[model samples]
Target: MTSNLTDNTLDLDQAITSIKIWDQIRDAAQKSLRSEPVLEKMAHHIVLSSKDMAQGLGRLLSHQQPDTLVSREELEELFSFVAERAPQIITFAAADLEAVCERDPAATDFFVPFLYFKGFHAIQMHRFAYWLWQNGRQDMALFLQNRSSVLYGVDIHPAAKLGKRIVFDHATGIVIGETAVVEDDVSLFHGVTLGGTGKERKDRHPKVRQGAMVGAGSILLGNIEIGHHARVAAGSVVLKDVRAHATAAGSPAKEVRG
Candidate 1:
């Protein structure tokens, strides 16, 4: 019984530590809503009334629809389905929100990214779409991808694998291919493309390892690997593997001494 109590305490501590930032964000949102009467309806619907992060995010994403192809009800149902089916979606979102607050100087609070940042919105939408893809709902995934591209100007393939703590700064015009894999703590700026050289399919996109920083307007082609902690300079065209901790620049990017 003593051992069970200790284990329970440790589990509770771990869970609280994991959601520390999320709790902070929720508290901040509530305070802000209280002070700003204009935001009462929107804030209450998106955050205050929400039971948890999953429900809050579901409502937020579902409300972004323009009522064309998918109605607000349909969008909400889809988001709720994904959130319930895969709880990891909320986990990734929390990490992502924390990442934006830590990495972007412009981000003042979690509510900023949760409400206004299209880059953050695009990534979360992709998470839902990716869940659909994994569950053999490819058509629905494609539909969400198309909607995300139209709304956010960021086109990430539904099948692409993404890790935690990724910051897509100014995510407009960012395109990631179907087979591309982005590891944790990676930062990508606007106009970055992880693409293939030719029409050949089958494992043809770039693999970006952990802690890499990809600059704006850069194009990385083929099945090349960008090693961990490497930096690719802006407007560079990379065609080869970049060694870990190295800096690659210029067209057909070559390693520059870091």
Candidate 2:
């Protein structure tokens, strides 16, 4: 009986550790409230009073919807429905928060990204939009895209498939085309455009592979692949494929490192 109890306790601890993100957010929220009691009302609305990550995300994302289009309650209901139907959205959101906290120096904990970071919010909205796009609700997906752009200055097409643990640092003016694919653990900076060279209706956008990092204002065009672990220099115009573990720079980006 004693051994069984001990094993059960250990299992429970491991389970909690696996999803320690929500736990960390709650703890950070409490700490923030203590540090600045004046922010109690605002904090409670999104984080402190929320039951879990999903609920908190619903509050934060729904609040971004313009009042002229959708009411707060309606957007919250939609967000909750999407989260329920595809629970992995929440999983991806948690991974995203983890990435921001681990990669962004400004983000010391989950609470900051959960409540204030537009990049984080934009990514969550993109995930929700991706779900809508996958479900054949393209109209709704576009609506969410518009909301994200107007609110965060990030324009990510609904059809763009994004993997987990991705970070969009200072994501303002970032544009991703319909067929673009961003793989896991990738990081993108502000003003980056993953667009096509011409009016090709087919798969013309870039495919950014896992662990690659794109600098700010970089433009990667065409049906090219940004190889795994590749790095694009800031303000470069990439017209060709960047090989794996390589660094590309210059106006028309050329391989500078391998």
Candidate 3:
């Protein structure tokens, strides 16, 4: 009886066609984004990320998924997830940019990418790896992290906890150490190092609290908290806690302003 029924009317191809499956799926995704402001914003980020990944993959392989490979349905799903997490990512990205502006007046010109320019395949991968690390999938996170660094020349450790609105301007030679904590609204300039003091076992890296900006070529080492709204001057080596709204300069940074 079962074989007879299957032979009589089981048509998987036709069933998919009858539903207008792909078309309906695409339309539904678009509808959800259009209906919700939050979803729409998230969709923008997701689309950017997807495009970046597609471009990166194309560069790494001889055979590549066409730039147009991202279907509307897939893009919608990506945006939906981004919408749910937009508050966090947006906050971090902002903090990062604010930090850059504090360090250099001209920083805005370069840091603009994190705000509007999308094509940072490496940045998207870093975000994904960081998410994996938070979920306790360290191996996969590390694998992605290494891959991103090898391909893009940017090495941000997955274990680093970054707050919302973080910016990495002119993003070359930037190294974010493990155990480093970047709070909201932080911006890091090129050649910035949030590093440790010679492999010390205990929390041996800088903690950039909210609204902190580390200038270009700065080396902030050891376990120290850069207080809220603090600025680490260019080429400085910071080794101590900087009070909130203060500015630090020189090696073993000294408080310059408040």
> Which candidate has the highest TM-score of all?
2
- Sort by lDDT, best first: 2, 1, 3
RMSD of 3: 15.0
lDDT of 3: 0.58
True lDDT of residue 12, candidate 1: 42
TM-score on alpha carbons, each prediction = 0.90, 0.91, 0.59
Q: Model 2 Cα displacement at 173 (Å)? A: 0.6
Which parts of model 1 are misplaced by more than 4 Å? 1-19, 34-36
Q: Provide the lDDT at 146 for model 2.
A: 92
Per-candidate local distance difference test: 0.84, 0.85, 0.58
lDDT of 1 by residue, 1-258 (tens): 001110112234433543675577678888887798898888888877887777788888888878776788788888998777676667677778888989999999888888889999998998888878888999999998998999899999999988867899999999999999888889999999999999668999999999899999999999999999999999999999999999999997999966
Let me know the TM-score candidate 1 reaches against the reference structure: 0.90
Query: What tens digits encode model 3's per-residue C-alpha lDDT throughout 93-131?
Result: 333334444554554432233223322334445555675
The TM-score of predicted model 3 comes to: 0.59
- Residue-level lDDT of model 2, residues 1-258, one tens digit each, is 001110112234433442678878878878888999998887788877777788889998987666775798998888898877776667777878888988999998888888888888998898888888888899989999999999999999998878878899989999999999898889999999999999677999999999999999999999999999999999999999999999999999999989
Worst 10 residues of 2 by lDDT: 1-10
Per-residue error for 31 in candidate 3, Å, reads 23
Candidate 1, position 252, lDDT: 78
